[model samples]
Target: MVFQCQRDSWARQFTTQVVSCCPAELQTEVSGKKATLQGFHVILEDTILFPEGGGQPDDRGFISDIPVLRVTRQGPDALHFVQKPLEPGSEVQLTVDWDRRFDHMQHETQLFIPGQHLITAIADQMFGFKTTSWELGRQRSTIELDTPTMTAEQVVALEQSVNKKIQERIPVVVTEFSAGDPEAETVRSRGLPDDHTGPIRTINIEGIDANMCCGTHVSNLSDLQVIKLLGTEKGKKNKTNLIFLAGNRVLKTLERCHGTEKALTSLLKCGAEEHVEAVKRLQNSMKLLHKNNLSLLRDLAVMTAQSFKSNQPFPPHRKDGDSEFMNIIANEIGTEETLMFLSTGDEKAAGLFLLAGPSAMVETMGPRVAELLEGKGAGKRDRYQGKATRMSKRAEVQALLREFTSHQSTEE
Candidate 1:
């Protein structure tokens, strides 16, 4: 179960014989779409590829030119999933992606070992805060401390303390002990898995801390480059999550933030430092403009309604408005005697309609007009309103309303 990867984390290439290869399927994403990948599960006699475990992702590499999509541990064997299969007992060259492996090592060091230890020590010693739990993410990580909140000043001090340790370049040593060894109790452990049957491994950071871990890690504190505390967020119960980035992640995050600042400067037409104030001013102006526009629209609605004759059937349509505006016009015109059909929207797209008049006439014509406009609506008393998708059929609806009103007057 102890693979070559765990024995020699620096190894990049290895030659091994394939033990078994079987047809398998991997669920993966391609071009932002979920898809099932048809592949083969290959087990090699020995491997340099680290399987996904201990909060670290699997290594990406090639097995004799065949791309390894994923590597996972099944029981005691590391399974390499690939598109093509190799014959059992065939010798193959396993090549690890060094850049990706190093990045993962840096992340694992900060997320699982050194970072957690540093935070726990400083928080408990300096602030009397206890770490409850932690989580590892691909780009960033967080350690939850048993505190309701962490002050900005405390965060700055914590970050400084962590980076100071990194500058010291403390050596990180990995030591293994037999399962029943008494020395194993000295290393901080959260108990082992029930199925575990190997020597216990502990990572020691010079005189700072020692904790049991199975993840790949950097050899020294200096390899982490720097630890950037990205503030904190509320966690479950009375806990606070301190989010952070380490090593190359810190540099990448700075680059992305600088790019965003440059874009904001150009868009706001101001210096980077003044971008926040500039955006606030623009938002205030927008609010005032919106208020004025609504007043003008209501004024227009009243004028249009007042221009209609009282005894005649009124059917008015607008290409640039909504259901609320149509209802405004219907309310101003008084829909008791005169049958009214009001609509507002683009001819090529969806719109809104309002039919208001006598209760009997509105109930009778509401469904017919809604059907013709390819919409659904319900009414109470004399008002019927709903959204319509076929605003282009406005002319047909107008004709239907005119004929109905004319026939009613003749019958009366």
Candidate 2:
């Protein structure tokens, strides 16, 4: 049946009789009464819900106070998916979600979201540049301009030009045409959809733009309040996505951005205007401090390694040739002559750096240490280095290394 939504974009209610409703699923209510509980498609004599179309979302609403989950187009009818079923031939009240409907209507304004319908359309008419595509967000919209060599200066110029037109507060005009009308085909913004036939709706923004469209829109450019271009992002096909804000969204974005700037200023200990430079300076200071600390750790490691050099035993070839052992510095914890266990990390986790006088000791104990950490270690030049997960087992690792060295000494 012909629907009110198709003709009157602002229709909010309908008192209709249910032609048919099939329950997609059934459930028992608290009164043990069977309830379809939504997911069922219902057909009414007529509806005010605009089904999903023209890249816009479907109308969400209530029928008989039950939620309308979704609305989709089927041939010539609008199908409303509802939570509960209504008896066929019964009368019901259908109400549209006015807030959502008006929000969509706000976005459809030529002054709010730039497209082939606003000053962008004028750009095409005046120059070779135009919007190739557009996207609408909750509080923002993006229109991809078709110029490949467009500059930042040019984008600013375009924004100023659009804003100038908006300040004029031009009235928007709607024109209709019969099927396959030559005038409808002449619209600059977009072509007809696949199934569009008969009457064609063309939107005109005074002398600026004229385009084929089905979405609802504002009556005047002034209702948009103002248009604020956020910036541009590189788009597909070398186009540029022009981000913008309008009306209530412009104020909302400004409020949100101010809050973010305040947070950054506090974190960097700087004024709002100086936040970026202050953050950069703080990061540089942190990098310098990290480099200095690493240098200190390396110097300490070298000193520790040198003390172990004299305590370790000489290779078999060196000992066989001379029959003497190198002397190691003695300490309460360990001396390198037999073994030295060095480690790093904190109470929760650590790593092991083991140096042994005899190669045999490193080969035998390294695997056991690795298993304890569920990790791997490698040995080279009498030093075994690897990460250990069981940091609290530092004493256990020392005991194992000691036991291995003692066994090798006994064999000798």
lDDT of 1: 0.84
On lDDT, the leading prediction is 1
- Writing each residue's lDDT as its tens digit, candidate 2 over 151-175 gives 6777687678777877898887767
- Model 1 Cα displacement at 123 (Å)? 2.9
- For each of the candidates, the C-alpha root-mean-square deviation to the true structure, in angstroms, is 3.2, 9.8
Q: Please list the residue runs of candidate 1 whose C-alpha ends up more than 4 Å from where it truly belongs after superposition.
A: 30-34, 97-100, 113-116, 307-319, 355-389, 399-412
**lDDT per model, in order?**
0.84, 0.66
lDDT tens digits, residues 1-412, model 1? Answer: 6788877788999999999999999999999999999999999999989998776789999999999999998877899999997999999999999878887777676545333465566667678877777776777888888899999999999899878988999888888898889999877777776656667877777877788877777789898898889999999998899998888888888999999999998888899989889999999999999888888888888877877654434646777677767778888878789788888887756888899999999999999999999998899899988888998888888899999999999999
- Residue 26's lDDT within candidate 2 is 29
Model 2 misplaced stretches (Cα beyond 4 Å):
1-38, 86-100, 111-115, 175-183, 188-191, 297-412
